[model samples]
Target: MLNGCYLTPPEPKVITITKPVPILPPLYLLNDIALSHPPINTNRELLKFAVKAHNQKVLCNLDKAALRAWRAKYE
Candidate 1:
């Protein structure tokens, strides 16, 4: 009778789920240097090689830094 209506259960609440966005690391481009041997007749050739090697080292360090930053933000 009318008492049955009062005994009915209430409707369930709707839950909303949101996904988290992914974090990405920066991209680094490496230089393509020729690995062939160069003539050592003058100091200029040695200096050129030294500069190229230094630049490559710097780029590698930058890559490591980017990875560290990404890991810090993620974890």
Candidate 2:
């Protein structure tokens, strides 16, 4: 009975918790726009095409800027 009392269980060990790694979101692809062909016929058509092209360019640039911002945040 004395020997059984002396045989005590061992102390519990300390467990260390590690920090989880950050996960990056998947990149989305942009679709290609159907551009107008050159003949352009009249001044009005040319102006319309020019404005549309400019808008598309601006949108593309915005997307690039957003991607850069995301990269900066992750890195």
Candidate 3:
């Protein structure tokens, strides 16, 4: 039986629409991996760790500023 149909079904009409994906931010960043390793399970441990991290961050900033100042002289 001869059927009057195209050799293959026509490709679906693709309508490409760009949509901005909405990213939902985390409710709490306390669980972020960047915060620390060996995740803390106790409030006391977390507080101690947080204080250490804060001090390290301040030291890192000072080192970065010193490096930038030295680099600026060469540039």
Candidate 4:
């Protein structure tokens, strides 16, 4: 018994669109990983950690003016 079906590979010119991925600082990822794995069970602690992660992400993505503002705020 022979079943005939043609399978074609993807064309060399095919374009793949990927989602915009946020780039996080190494420090940011390390901090998040450290916080997320802790045995602490307090809502306040968790919220603090979330804020840190979000702020770090925002800082990573800031434009020139935003970066200046952030620097001014911190320094």
Error of 3 at 11 (Å): 90
- Candidate 3's displacement at residue 72, Å, is 0.6
The total of clashing pairs for model 1 equals 0
Which candidate would rank higher by TM-score, 2 or 4?
A: 2
RMSD of each candidate relative to the true structure: 6.0, 5.1, 14.6, 17.2
Instruction: Write the candidate numbers in order of decreasing TM-score.
Output: 2, 3, 1, 4
| Pairs with backbone N, CA or C atoms under 3 Å apart (clashes), candidate 4 | none
List runs of model 4 lying over 4 Å from the truth. Answer: 1-40, 63-75
Arrange candidates, best lDDT first: 2, 1, 3, 4
Which segments of model 2 are wrong by more than 4 Å? 2-38
TM-scores for all candidates?
0.44, 0.51, 0.49, 0.30
Off by over 4 Å in 3: 1-35
What does candidate 2 score on TM? Answer: 0.51
Clashing pairs in 3: none
Per-model tally of clashing residue pairs: 0, 0, 0, 0
Across 1-75, the per-residue lDDT of candidate 2 in tens digits comes to: 588668678999999999976665454443334555577889999998899898997888777667667766877
lDDT of 1 by residue, 10-63 (tens): 899999999997765434332223345566777988898878877876777776
- Candidate 4 residue 74 Cα shift, in angstroms, is 31
The number of the candidate with the highest TM-score is 2
Top candidate when judged by lDDT against the true structure: 2
